[model samples]
Target chain A: MARVATGDAFTSTQRAEIDRAIRDAETVSRLEFSVYVGRSDGETRPFAQRLHAALAAPARSVLIVVDPPARIVEVVTGGEARRVLDDEEVKLAILAMQSAFAAGDLAGGVVRGVQQLAEHARKPQLRHTD
Target chain B: MAPFHALLILFLLPAGLFLVITLLVYLPSMRHSEGYQPGQVWRGEPEWFGGPRKGVEAIDETEPAAVGSGRDGGESGRGGASGHW
Candidate 1:
């Protein structure tokens, strides 16, 4: 599909892809994924956390907040999300995001980060060990 | 000290100071800087990379995103982490 202008973080196409990524992440991991990009209202962490808290399923949601001008990227996962997605794993996602953000690929950074989070949060296939 | 010795000290002091200042100013920043990666196409406008332009299709600005078909209800219990780069 052709790209359309969207007066937000990403273009219509970019938003569509990001939305798709979130869909895939949720499908695989059974967790909620949210990406918020914009100039932070204030301190990024608090703003991001607040955003996370206000989600439909905050307890199972993962919020990725990116403040480009401020150069702050926060990944706040909910209770269950953290249980599955873990700190070290999320940190890995954050590092991937940090690299992409540093390289000036906001959309790509978000996409990679979301994909990483989903992979980490994915439920492992059970193995029958006798 | 000899005139030559005094001249050497004078030159050395400034040169050494310059070197130290340069190190102090640039080293930490360079260390902190994320390593260069080539070719990342930013979406939307140049400024969009800076942050969300508007949060267009976001669910709740307080929270966000598009999720799976069923309502997973990904609630918040003060879980997760945060950082910057």
Candidate 2:
């Protein structure tokens, strides 16, 4: 696991990983990926909204927010993106991340979630009829 | 001019100076280098990671179908305005 700075900011390595996740999602599908981490006041909804606005994807981005200590995870997909990454798929990714979080593995959770998104987004190669 | 007042000032001066120095000299540079501005958004560009270049046509054409599958899951309503914590 990579070491992240303890402050409210993400380390360079963590940012790089996030960038990679976005790329992975883009490769598998058109849906964009963005992650937000910080302390929220009372609820995580506002933070999630802020993240959604920050990413500014073309109505097809997935925003994941992890609030510290509370251990809550919020996954939000834009209108167009929601069409491809259904609730079940999002739940599966969240479950995978939850398992990693239980083990005190933040990096692992993000990595696994990104990979799952990629796999879920993959399109099977078209078969050709001669 | 009590002894306690002298002692209190003596103790506070150095500590205050140290905090001021840390905040003024060290904190800003740290935040800037780490991209830690308040209310600032970090944008991830897909092109840098060898993904589809912005403004270019995507090679993968199955995105619409995948999105359609997600839409059919019937949880679209739940997705709106739901907070995790």
Candidate 3:
């Protein structure tokens, strides 16, 4: 397969893999998932929050921000998303990603982290509506 | 040994072996050159996947305080975690 080189943090194939992971996560959790791979303007936490706030529907969104140069990874869950994914759950995902990043697998870390988050936030199945 | 045999043993064999060894050692590193390494300066532009295409630009222009203010509602429902490698 030909690798498409883009002037971006990830190669085209890597981006597509992340996109698919996000899509699957969204499908499972019924929440929007966005990934930002780049340097933050200031503190990574606040920058991630702002990006989360900018989403079309902040209440149902999850934003993952990764700053490779700074070695920072932040996950921000909006109003509604926070309900299903608490701080503890997010922390678990963060740890998983941190280990992967430590080994220089940026795209792989993001994909795994997103998938883990979605699994944790998966909507409860309705047994009966009667 | 004949001239042809000596040439094959000393020149052709070593040249072939060197070429093979060089390729084996160099190709894998080239394939992995794009991966991010800790402490390496990042040169790529920022990218947002699954984010609002246009709204994100505007967020960067607004005062950081205003964005922070969004956290003030009584619910303060936003939650997440951060980490470093």
Which is the better candidate, 1 or 2, if ranked by DockQ? 1
lDDT of each: 0.68, 0.57, 0.84
True contacts kept of each: 0.31, 0.09, 0.66
Superposition error at B21 for model 2 (Å) = 32
Give the CAPRI class of candidate 1.
Answer: incorrect
lDDT of 3 by residue, B13-84 (tens): 999999999999887645654655555567777888998868459576655553574344335578888899
Q: For model 1, how does the per-residue alpha-carbon lDDT over A1-130 read when each residue is reduced to its tens digit?
A: 4333333455455666788888899899998888877667667776666666556676688888877667788887777677787878988998999988887677789999999999999998899999
DockQ of 3: 0.28
lDDT of 2 by residue, A1-130 (tens): 4344334344456567767776777788766776555554466654454445444452667767766445677776666776666767888888888777667565557667777866776667779988
Would you list the rank order by TM-score, best first? 3, 1, 2
After the best TM-score superposition of candidate 2, give how far the Cα of residue A108 lies from its true spot, in angstroms: 1.7
Taking chain B only, the TM-score of every model is 0.36, 0.34, 0.40
**Model 2 per-residue lDDT tens digits across residues B1-85:** 8998887799878889889988997665466445332223423222212223431123233244333322224333224222232
TM-score of 3: 0.76
The reply for model 1, stretches above 4 Å from the true place, is: A1-8, A127-130, B1-77
Checking candidate 2 for backbone clashes, the offending pairs are A83-B67, A84-B66, A84-B67
Residue A58 in model 2: shift from native, Å? 5.1
